[model samples]
Target: MAGLVRWDGFSADPRRTEVAGVRASDGDRETAVEALREAYADGRLDRTEFDRRSQAALSATLLGEFAPLLQDLEAPAPAALSVRDEAVRRYRRETRDARNAVLTVGTMTTGIWGATSVFNGDVYFFWPIFPILGVGVGWLMQVVNRGQRIEHHERRIARRLGRRRDADREDDGDA
Candidate 1:
């Protein structure tokens, strides 16, 4: 009666209250093993220590067992940010290239027009508009394409996250 706790007519077991005593799943063991691998790769653990810890990780049956194996190691960086950053950098580079293309075309057309007017001492026609419009339209297309690419990238990331969430839910259900 002293240690008993009831919820909706169901008694809670005191022995199950500690999370550290929980059993580790295969996935947890894999994660600990991966961390050990990273630590070894980062030179935090030598070959012999890595091999020993790796064996321990594979043979571990409780979450508490992984504590010693990963205690000295730093967590690996998240992969999502690196991928997103690279995509953003590529987009920015493409945007800069598009802007440069427009600027170059505009400058060349204006230069040709100015030289013609200076040499002839008369303005015959607005012939530069054709090339400007042509290049402008092409650049516009590139901008539109870039926007689409960004949208596509966003959708792809969303889909990937969705899949990951679904996978996590499935794992939870199994647990």
Candidate 2:
């Protein structure tokens, strides 16, 4: 139990002592259960054993409880560059956020401009155009850099995974 690694394969349990019990998060339990499910699907465990392990994973309250449940199973290596689905979704979401910001600024500025012209006897000044143009330039730049931005996103993921593997190796050495 000294060097027990989590299902994520990146970190080790710091201690196995009763006084130093590390509490498990809901995410920890879910990860353990997911690993168990994969093992069950691969026929590595029989139905009864799978059910028992899955239940234990779900009910676990401490990090130590999870170590034993997944000690024998291997963690899957994350794909280095296959962030297509998530990366695209994130990219689209980012673009939407920028669009929303632009829309909000444009609407507010235009309304203010209209109010000033009507109620203050001010001359018609299309001042909203300046701010809108500024934000619009940023949005245009983002769209133009779409491919490089996506590639950069993918590389960040790949680098994180590479670091995880290195950490796992160091943990194994400690064990």
Each prediction's Cα lDDT score? 0.64, 0.70
lDDT of 1 by residue, 51-138 (tens): 9999997997776676666656653454435546645554665576667777888789888988999899997687878877887787
The TM-scores, one per candidate, come to 0.38, 0.51
Q: Write the per-residue lDDT of candidate 2 for residues 1-175, one digit (tens) a residue.
A: 2211334531335235562267777877776786686666545679899999999978978877876777776533444325675466557666766887789889999999999898989769798999998998878777888997777767865675587688779879999
Best by TM-score: 2
The list of candidate 2 runs beyond 4 A from truth reads 1-81
State the displacement of the C-alpha of residue 49, model 2, in Å, after optimal TM-score superposition.
41
Evaluate residue 172 in candidate 1 and report its C-alpha lDDT on the 0 to 100 scale: 92
Colliding pairs, model 1: none
Model 1 error, position 166 (Å): 23
